[model samples]
Target: MKKITNAFRLTLSLILIAVVFSGCLIREVEQPATVKTGGEFQVKLTITDKTADANAHYGAVCVLAPDDWEFVSGSYDSQVGTGIFLFDSSAKPVYGNIDSVLAPPAGMKWIKLLSDAAFTNPADVIHEATINLKVGQKTGDYNIGYFTTKNSADLLGSLNMSDEDNDNAWSDTSMNHKVTVELAVGVEDEKVVPTKFSLDQNYPNPFNPETTIRYSLPVSGYTTLKVYDILGKEIAVLVNGSKQAGQHSVQFSANNLQLTSGIYFYELRVGDSSASDKSEFSEFKETKKMILTK
Candidate 1:
């Protein structure tokens, strides 16, 4: 046997400790039970860093979803939990797109999430964020799987990752995190009436040129849908003087208006404008956010 240096032994011990205590794991995942076809939904993820003592390291979360579902860039990076690294997808490993790089499955893809968020210091620290995505025309029940990696050994963008990472890499399929997409039937499907007033999030957000805004009306009256800039400045009026008690959609085209790219708000005022008191006349008033990418 060859003589081993003291430095070598100490270094080996540290590596083993990291592998054992690199406690980064997804603690919980929240997803919607049902979403309309071609509608947008969000996934809330809670990740915990559990260790006796903390080490300065990084972690990542990968979501397994069908290829038909589009990943819409939204606030996943903005609302990272306290003491977490700055979450950013721009740092994603780009070995020729995520699908070809991770090779999820025949009909699905792997969406990897990373953070500047850290759990350094006392153990048991956690991080939270929401991922936005849009469903396609397909309507069916689907399972969403999650995979996590901790420790400094396999940081995201690590060139060392091999080609073997695929559907097999995403685990815990039985966790039962599933989303069901129902067929989208418009107002033409008169059999189905909306139980309550609601406004769905815009799909393909951070959209350039055009995007569609959808709203539901339990009881019909006069309605007006208008777009406003971040400054509360009125931008465009997409709809006015509407009727019918059913789902409705309006297309907003920024290209035609020559509007610059920025965050915009859309307000839905449903009720009667002919009434003396405008506030009391309105049955419902709701507003939602959408991003414009010129």
Candidate 2:
């Protein structure tokens, strides 16, 4: 009887440990290994609220970058991700410059994006953010940091402290992530921006199930990327919202679509977002074909 009681206590202790450590799950969706001297580098983050606290919610996402990367306030494009962490009806991210008495860890700076997203109930919510940057002339391997919080108060105790020692730096293992990027020297631009609109063909022309599509925009606009069958029926809407001016890529897979082996066409459409009708077309209405084998 005593052994049974001890086993019950052990199971209860393990459950408590899991509850204490599981807060949010942040994963590195996509990133670059190397970038040109003044070229575009991208990072995609997938964050899910696991604890889903009813008292306070997470509405802000932050990035910790090396100062030499020169991630100035006006350097890169900050577009609203077409995810649940939206700022308004049109889905734009509220770019904020957090400068004052607060500073990030030495040699690093924080880029905070506040949204109207919530974990109001007990359900888990997922949010994604894609950040595109044109790094400076500095060339070397550097680590980029990422985190999300409810507000500034949760971050006050984390400044400059080592991640292993700073309990307040982040809530769980997923909240604190580090990504390394190698930068090479090349033609440096005064500011990083796409020169024009372009739509590259799908990679791995004869992919069995998965492939990637790349595109670029010189300016911010309402854009849509779609995949169609040989007969022109829409199969998937890859992107349909406002996109910041820079280089971007999206992946397509056939596992969920139950697609058969054949030729497929993908189209990219962009227009001036200021007008009521954005599909009138100013620079791009391009389509390309790719082959998928079963």
Give the winner by TM-score: 1
Compose the digit string of candidate 1's lDDT tens values, residues 1-294. Answer: 111122111000000000011344454555566666666565555544444334554444455566676565333222223311222354444222334434465666565544434444465555554555666676677755544444354333332132132222211111334456677667353345677787655655657888888788888777888999989999998887856888888888887677887778889888864676544536888887777776
Per-prediction TM-score: 0.54, 0.40
| Candidate 2 segments exceeding 4 Å error | 1-22, 53-58, 70-106, 116-121, 152-170, 173-294
lDDT of each: 0.53, 0.50
What is the Å distance of residue 235 in model 2 from its true position? 28
Worst 10 residues of 1 by lDDT: 10-19
**Top lDDT hit:** 1
**Which stretches in model 1 have alpha-carbon errors above 4 Å?**
1-62, 72-106, 112-141, 146-174, 179-191, 272-276, 279-282
For model 2 the local lDDT of residue 84 reads: 21
Candidate 1 at 268: error in angstroms?
1.7
